[model samples]
Target: MSSSTELTEKKVFLLKSLDGVIFEVEESVAVQLEVIRELIEGDCARPFISLYNVTSEILALVIEYCKHHAETCSGGTSATIADEDLKTFDNEFMNVDENILLELCSAADYLDIKSLFELTCRTLASLIKDRTIIEVRKMFNVENDFSVVEEKAVRKEFAWAFK
Candidate 1:
């Protein structure tokens, strides 16, 4: 095997999102999706894969996250510097709108990208933890199924949680 090949010469895979947008990702980026890794290991990974559950917007974000992580982890830098860079990148990546954030979370889960899934979940947990029940519901766009009286009673029952 020739180790002299440049990074740009690496093999790439095509991923098609539900919205029919096609994205070309290098093998390093594609392997970050555990589902794709499994298919690759089993020799079943096609040159092009279709993801029916992910929209183009979400898929693009997920690919970006994976590509960044891959490059940072494999880059010629000290471990401390790479870790710090990734930390900063992840913090900034989670700054999208709530709807897009949730979509990215779901897409990450669907793609079996554990790191991205965990990041999104942690960010959401932090956001929800500091907000009131109404605020949390609004953030998630959850329709209130409980009447005001029911909500008040429940909150009174679990006053410590509300606090």
Candidate 2:
């Protein structure tokens, strides 16, 4: 029922985040996501993509990340830059406190960017590698919501690691 030209031409997409902020992004970028692309390519008249779990702050970060990668992929940077320089830039860009890093990881996962997800996971793993359970929980703001006995039991179970 649809012409091929309509499919190929750029379409504007409306993405609504959890905090009620609406973002208008290009169809190309939206299509980079399989679910969104399928929805767009479908014959639905009103395709309002609602991201119900992502906060406004997280959405902003995700948009910034996508825009940055899009620019990089579109060759906005100088070709003369050395690989080392690029690596340094990536390192610096990813460097953040644990809370922001966790949020970034969640955002990446929600956005379905596997590479960014993996990178953030690896970064968190690296940060936690040498930290104690208490330190890890503190860093992540994970409440010791468990009962005292349960908390002690878990701590005892990993006593060797803690010691």
Model 1: per-residue Cα lDDT over 1-163, one tens digit each? 5565674487778898998999999889998898778776676767678899999988989988999999999998999999999999999999999889899988988899999999999998887877876788887888999989998898898789755
Deviation in Å, model 1, residue 150 alpha carbon: 3.1
Give a tens-digit lDDT track for model 2, residues 1-163: 7999987886678888898998877764665554455677784515568877778777777666655555566665575554445456557767877778898888778767776687789888988999876898888878878998998898898788766
Lowest-scoring 10 consecutive residues by lDDT in candidate 1? 1-10
- Each model's lDDT comes to 0.88, 0.72
TM-score for all predictions? Answer: 0.88, 0.69
Model 2 residue 124 lDDT score: 89
RMSD of 1: 2.5
> Which clashing pairs does model 2 show?
none
lDDT, residue 14, candidate 1: 87
In TM-score terms, candidate 2 sits at 0.69
User: What clash pairs does model 1 have?
Assistant: none
Q: Give per-residue lDDT, candidate 2, residue 112.
A: 78
